[model samples]
Target: MTRETLTWLNTMTLIGHTDRRGTAWHYKASEQGGEPNHYPGAIPLKDVRARLFNWEGVHRRVAVELPASTFTEATHYGLDNKPMRWEVIGNRSALDRSDRDTGAVFGVVGPDYKIHQYSDWLLENVAGLLHDGLSVSSAGLLKGGAVAWVEVSVPENLMTDEGVEFRPNLLATTTMDGSSATVYKRTITDVVCDNTRAVALKESGAEFKVRHSKNSELRLEQARDALQIVDTAADEFRRQVAELCAIAVTEDDWQLFLDRTVPWGTKTGKPDNDYMRLLKEERRENLTYIYRNDPRCAPWHGTAHGVVQAVNTYDHHVRLPQKKEDQEPDRVSSWRTDRNLQRTVDGLFDELDRETYLDLEAVLEQAA
Candidate 1:
């Protein structure tokens, strides 16, 4: 094939080659599409996805579509855009069981934001457990003065299994309110598990800086209190995300994020009040079709609004934020909503609420 410039959007993957059925997902690019050419060849997964996403960002317009042949040399349309093809060059074996999949492989790995996130979760959860020790003996627990607890008897004046005896006797942090309190015996292991989980829920974030005090009881108390702090912080985190989602889903903030990268363009780069109004229109699909670089598109300046147009085009699109706004916005023509973020926070709340009140000792269960 003769070399030619593809200055326009021309690199959309033909769906004919890739496979997607019922529910099984595929992220492996080489396995998904294109001729096995050398693919059963070597191509960087990132390279393939970048083309897919950039094509998506471009909104998939084209100057000349490839013919039926699978041998088109994927090269840059822009004078500076990098070439977009990969071919596996070589491979060898490492062990009898392990085959060396290493070759002149060309591609970049997807971002590792997910792996770092899971590591963070582990650090938080473990810190909570180490700080808070379990106090199994509370009110409504073991009646008839015979309990299944570990039974550490302290001075009558010092903290007791129940708590300090005051003018009004303090309540036990852990309690039992089952059918027959006189007959039921709460196991030490069960009580310990509950208290520890409560501690984990409360102080998951604090163990990072707060040192464990030399006093065993003090350390436990600190751990338990920290859990409560973690609970409130987690909620605040969610509410903030929700607040930002308004800008997020709408790409209202994209102008700020975009300004850092996108170049000034021919467009007016101002928020199209007229365009925001189209979002409220009755039939938006038709409106969207008209909004993609059409004469009428001048009004669609919001990041989310631009995204809707990109979705319609299956092409790459970049919108420069209007410099007129008080806060310079950023570029993000494609954005996705944060799914299940609130649900995770709700689960954390449920765990914290399990134990909530006490005069001084750790709260074993909800106060009555």
Candidate 2:
């Protein structure tokens, strides 16, 4: 596909706990990388209601915690008023005596994920195809409440004879934390470890993002047309993967790729210290492993795809210490690192394509 149009697949799995009120209700989020702004904390039910009325807009789902003592335990009724097995709480705030106390009400409830909603949409969009042997193999939330995605895969009988199990998947995700636009892209998931890398050779027609905004509902309604591009996307991805597989790489070529993609020690003519050298050496090793191991790049382990995977896997899986920060750089959320790595890969490929003098020959030679 055109480098000019390529963008990052910036979405994460939705992480949540069953508890919907108080501090214990929310799932504990890691704060390794400092993301003070997007801390995954729960807000009170009242505050959620306030936001709803104020038109502030929540990304996906909202959770309300009703204690058993406050409300009447009545038989659960579905939207159709049919009685369900489970008991349902009737009044939410019956126990709360204070009515006018409008202070900063903070607790753990949610702007949690709308998991069911997302799943229903996916099924409705592809119901007819699913009946024809295609199925949803994997579905989950990514990066603590940042995004939700579902991967619909081709039937096992229809898989390509690509030596590896490289199947075309329709990866659909919607962002809840406003990290990036909601994207429904056609991609190939390496079924081995479930690693999904965006298919880069050609852009899918169904692969479009709806930016998070006040009019997100309208945008979602529009996304139906985009989601229908699955068949075309799957065909193109197969073609592209086949092309990449045909190309090959050597050890020297791999080294050259590492030289080009991985950052070496800075050339300030200052003390080329032991730590810097160690850092460079570790990165070199990590890149080498990713190049060799990632299944998505298995067919093209020495080609452009391999190099991109090396960078991506390094950033996404490898834990590297920051130069200034005391702790190792933690991911801001689930898909932040993935998104950043993809962005880097996108830019590198773009430069390689457009710039005539951007080859790794010189970098490789210098290292030699």
Each prediction's total of clashing residue pairs, residues at least 3 apart in sequence or on different chains, is 30, 7
Error of 2 at 5 (Å): 35
lDDT of 1: 0.23
The whole-model C-alpha lDDT of candidate 2 against the native structure comes to: 0.42
Q: In candidate 2, what are the lDDT values of residues 1-368, reduced to their tens digit?
A: 11111111211222111121111111234431222111123222222223211122122222243333323453455466554344323321111112223332211122322212343344345443443434454333333323445555554412344643455656555544434555666655444323455555333223665554434442434444444555455566566556655555568767666666555656664654798778778878876776687564455576544554455445555544353332423333323344433432233322332221224434445555
In candidate 2, stretches whose alpha carbon ends up further than 4 angstroms from where it belongs are: 1-133, 142-146, 157-162, 201-206, 212-227, 267-272, 289-368
Q: What is the C-alpha RMSD of each candidate to the true structure, in Å?
A: 26.2, 16.4
Q: In model 2, where is the ten-residue run with the lowest total lDDT?
A: 2-11
Supply candidate 1's per-residue lDDT for 302. Answer: 37
lDDT for each residue of candidate 1 in 5-60, tens digit (9 for 90 to 100): 11111122111111111111112234434532112212233333233212110011
Top-lDDT candidate index: 2
